[model samples]
Target: MAAAAAPKSNAPHIPVLLRPLIAAVAPVQGVWLDGTLGAGGYARALLDAGADQVIGVDRDPLAHDMAQGWGAEYGDRLRLVLGNFAQMDDYATDLDGVVLDLGVSSMQLDLAERGFSFMKDGPLDMRMSQEGPSAADLVNTAEESDLADILYLYGEERASRRIARAIVKARTEAPIETTLHLAGLIERCLPRSKPGQAHAATRSFQAIRIAVNDEYGALIAGLEAAERALKEGGQLAVVTFHSIEDRIVKRFLTARSGGGGTGSRHAPEITREEPQFTLKSRKAIGPDDEELAVNPRARSARLRVATRTDAPAGQSERSALGVPMLKGAK
Candidate 1:
């Protein structure tokens, strides 16, 4: 349930913020893990930048298949593993560094069969691992209120109630089996998009996909896993493509780095645990004008890096990180 990459198969595969990422964690050596190895862009760059070995971990089988062709040139320097980044601690411990690109790859999005995009008409199956109760199943089976919560909480869609109601009404006629069918249904419930605006169904589509993949849940687990897996002085670099993703990463780093201040003026200053990570920068890094000209997709991307400390890793507060959980979910 990594971040789903925007569909851009026709476009060149340039790893977002690759240049700045390398510069941020310069002198990259020792074993590194690329947690969301979408298209293997980060893994290849890490290897080229002198990492002794890059362990590429991804839940999607497509990523591994694609890596087989390009990763071969790197020989043993590149190690591919099939699993979620949430279990990264199980994959390797005492890592020199970890790089996570949360976005789904263009290969998955561009292919209509994979069903990651609303633009293309495909089965409503947005499962990143290719195994799950797919988007179609959720839409056809979930309660209207549950659907509304997913759209509002996960995608920040304002008209979630209306859309969910419409979905329930329509599903009775027939199952919402394809991407365009759902997209069109969502479009009918919302105002039309103006020039330079996103599609009317964008938020709803994103919400359904996120729910199907459990993206936010995976993201939180993955960050903690990175903390447990990394060695002291090990760097963790994350490239987030959306505001929610960035906010979660920012808060996680802030709390771990001991920058989270007291809740209120009257609140007691409690003793804090030893900081687990040190922020490389107080602010997130974004694509520059030069990079934007080459890849506009990088425009929304933000990079955050932090170095591990010797402190023992601990669970992060989900509310503190703004992770949206559906009601009735623990």
Candidate 2:
């Protein structure tokens, strides 16, 4: 597959933690999977790194369109799928390696109509799939208590009750249908900061987007699917941009690494299982100063990787692990 010309954008979509990810996954000539094909950044990299073929999965139709332009250069080596990565098992067959870069892309946040940002004015829509109920629907229609819980749990906002009360009060008069209106409401409820602090709307917007997109839930399901899909000795590398998402990935990798858990010690050791995946690094990797200077978005990024142990191929089963059935359409 030949490389294509870079997209005509002010800043190119630079895949985060590229060096560490490539080193850990060690992509070879095989069927590779890019679970979150945002702007086709990592997908292009994998092909360039000598991957024989790649299956790129994304929920956004616009992403599929952009990938089509890229596929023209790769010829039959690229297969683009318009769907969520959470159901990766449904599409992936004979996978060698998988890479998942979670959270919203810079392109989505910059696009006003996508409604992923609190910095810019746009509609209240925050559906990553562009088909589900938006942030506006959740804020306007959900009960006050439920809304408060979502902000508190997903957003980690200390003044969740106050924010929920403010939202309910404003929506009673008129629907909170725009990004700026909601950001303004959140800012009003927050106490004035001393100095050198971010806007109060940052956390609220993050929380609402998480709730609207079911991001945490999707991450859990996607990880389980990736685990099940990998062949023994295959690798899974994930890059997360938020603390909440990182925590989930950390816990999952830790559990799989046999770092102590509540399971019976007498029963078969978890690490001895057929589909075991060993941690490639003790701690999550972060970008160096050079990358951070060029792309500020790299600051919050964290990468975790694991390699599938050498066990009998095609003998692993998800039923043995009893992974929870995921909610929502993939």
Candidate 3:
């Protein structure tokens, strides 16, 4: 395999926390899998860092298309798979390492046609795989209460009911068809944003996108898949963008590392068994000043790393992971 090349000025997007992530999992080698191979930043880095082979998996066809150009440089050493990371175990097992960078890819957000950005005006579609129900479908058809649940639970939007009511009202006049249309509607429903604060529509858009993609559900499933796929001593490094994601990763690691105890003071004590993984650190790695200077988008990114144990992989209770669920969702 070829050595990893220096980052190009025209690179699709900067890989957040790349330096810290590499350092945390130093001496990167053997066969590894990159679960969220968006722009192939991590994949390229791993390959360059001495991984003999890297399987890049993503559900978005855009990722696969983009991979064709740069991936050719690595030839057979870099393999691309068009599927969600939740099914990573089926792709390969006994892996040396697995890297999952959660959240929408920068490539997807930069493309207006992909409808991930509020800054860009385009369709209301937020499908990572570019299939299934889109943001537009949910915005126009979902019941007001359900939309409210998504906004409050997924995006942590405080004015969820207000926004949901507005959406229901606006869609009745005509379908909420485009990105800007929905963004504008949401902005109208909220108070004006203060300088340096996120846009008024930010939380609502994030919630809608999460609902449209089943991101949280897939995240838990992917973590479990990583647990099952890695061999003893295999490493798992996950980078999460928001608090909710970071919390889930932290809890999953805690539970698997044998720190998880009873649900509450009133709850029954749970039995323990051989743990499946060992935590590399109880703390998550965040971007340093240099990284923040280079890429402000990485400000919220958090990386957690753990090593697989010889114990057999087991399923985790989703409820314990702090996965926000809509009412009645299983």
Give each model's whole-structure lDDT: 0.90, 0.80, 0.90
Global Cα RMSD, each model: 2.9, 5.1, 4.0
> What's the TM-score of every candidate structure?
0.95, 0.88, 0.95
Q: How do the residues 206-229 of candidate 3 rate in per-residue lDDT, one tens digit apiece?
A: 888988989998999999999999
Model 2: ten consecutive residues of lowest lDDT: 320-329
Report the alpha-carbon TM-score of model 1 versus the true structure.
Answer: 0.95
lDDT (Cα, 0-100) at 268 in candidate 3: 73
Q: Candidate 3, after superposition: displacement of residue 301 in Å?
A: 0.4
Q: How accurate is candidate 3 locally (lDDT)?
A: 0.90
In candidate 2, the residue pairs with backbone N, CA or C atoms under 3 Å apart (3 or more residues apart, or in different chains) clash, namely none
**Model 3 CA deviation exceeding 4 Å by range:** 1-9, 263-270
For candidate 2, the C-alpha RMSD (Å) to the true structure equals 5.1
Report the lDDT tens digits of candidate 2 across residue range 18-112: 88788777746588899999888888889989899999998877677677676789988899998989899899855888899998887788777
